[model samples]
Target: MKLQDSVIAITGGGQGLGRAMAEYLAARGARLALIDLVPEKLEAAAEACKAAGGDARAYTCNVAREADVEATFASIIEDFGQLNGVINNAGILRDGLMIKARDGEISKRMTLAEWQAVIDVNMTGVFLCGREAATKMIENGDKGVIINISSISRAGNMGQSNYSAAKAGVAALVPVWAKELSRYGIRAMGIAPGFIETEMTASMKPEALEKMSAGIPLKRMGKPEEIASAAAFIIENDYMSGRMIEVDGALRL
Candidate 1:
C-alpha cells in the first residue's frame, strides 16, 4: 500500500493525468515502469520521476494490442523484479457524434470504426492490462492494487457514445474483479474524473470551457494532481476496493 520502494507500472504515463500520477507516486519512492506511445513525452516523464528521487524506466507500447502489452509487461517485470501495483491509465479519445450526415447533422447511430477504435483502446486495452497485472499479482502471491482510470462520461455523454459505453463497461467490472481477485489480495477500483485541465482539453474554445466550468459545483476544471492524489489515497487505503471515486468537482458530466 505504501508507495515507498514499491514497484508500479503505469500505462500512458507520458502526459496528462497519468504523468501527474507517476510523479506523485515516484516522489513517494515508488519504482516506476512507464509505458507510452510517444517516446519524447515518456522521456520527459521519466526524467521528472528520476528527479523526484525514484527509479524509473520507460517503454513504448500500444495498449490496444495484447501482444504489445504482454511484451511490455514482460520487459517491465524483468527490469523491476516484481510489481506491487498497476495503474491502467492509458486511453485515447475519438470524440464524434455517433452519426453525422453529409450536412454535418449528428444522430444517435454510431459508425463501426468510431465505436471499435474507442473500444479497442479504452475498453480492450484496460482489459488486457488488468488481466496481465492480475495474473502477475496472483502468480507472485503478492498483495497488490489495480487502478482503472474511468471518466465522468461513463454515465453517458451526448457525443461520446463510444467513450461512454466503454467507460461504463469498465466501471461495471470493478466489483466483479474485486470479488474475484480479493482472495489473492489484489484490490480493484475505478476513478471517474471530471473536466481536468489536461492537454486534451487545452484546445477547447474558451466559451465552451467556461460553460463546462459553470456546470460543476466547483465552477472550474480539475488539475491532474487532484486525480493523482485520489490514486494515492486509494492505493494506500487497503480496505477501499470494489468501488469508484469521482474526482469531478461535483460535476455530473
Candidate 2:
C-alpha cells in the first residue's frame, strides 16, 4: 500500500479536494491518473502534480458514463502499466427540498432531473469507477484501495434531499465493496467531510459560511489538505477498510 511509484486514479481531479489529493499524493511519489470532465482543469491538475515531482497524466472523463469510466481506466493501466488505487471523488450538488411549501401550500418540488443528475454523478459514478478499478486490480493480483468521498449531508440535511440521498448511498457502498472485494485484495473505505473550504463552499454567501462554521466545534472550516492527509493515511494503512472516517471537525448536520 505504499504510495511511492504506485499508480492511483482520481476522479474530479480538476479542482477542489480532488486536486489537493492529487498534489499531496504526488508529493509522496505516487503516479497519478487525473480524471475530470473539463480538459483544461484536468490538464492543470496534472501539471500541478508534475510540479509536485510526480509522474501524472490527465484524462477527460465523465465518471457517470460507463463507457467513459471503463475507457479511462484502460488508458490509465496502459499508461501506468498498473492500477494501484482509485478515488471516487467526482460529485455535483443539486440541492432542493423534496417539496417546497409557501403559505402552507405546495409551491415547488424537487424535480426528477435534479435527483437523477446528482445520483448519476455522485452514486452511479462511484460504482462504475470502483468496479473498473477492482476488476483491474483483481486481474493483476494487486492489492489496492478505493476511497469514496462522502459528505456530512449523508446524515440528511434540509433542502438537500437529492444531495443527501446520493451521499448516503456513496457511504453505503463502502462496506459492501469492502466485504465483496476484500477476497480479491481490494480495500474499500469512505471519507465523509464536513464543510471544507473548497470552491464549492466558497460560493456560499459570507454570512452563510460564517454561520455554518460557527456550528462546528472547531468554529472553522477544514482545509482541502487536511482531507488529503486522511486519504494518504488510508492509502498507507493496509488494515483499514469497510468503514468511513469522518473528517468533519466534529460537525453533525
- lDDT of residue 10 for candidate 1: 93
lDDT scores for all predictions?
A: 0.89, 0.93
For candidate 1, what is the total of clashing residue pairs?
0
Q: What is the lDDT of residue 37 in candidate 1?
A: 96
For all candidates, the clash counts are: 0, 0
What TM-score does structure 1 among the candidates reach?
0.95
**lDDT tens readout by residue for model 1, 27-131:** 988989898999999999999999998889999999999999889888877787787888999887778876766667654566798789999999899999999
* Candidate 2 segments exceeding 4 Å error: none
RMSD vs true structure, all candidates: 2.1, 1.0
Q: In candidate 2, residue 157 scores what lDDT?
A: 92
Question: What clash pairs does model 2 have?
Answer: none
Best by TM-score: 2
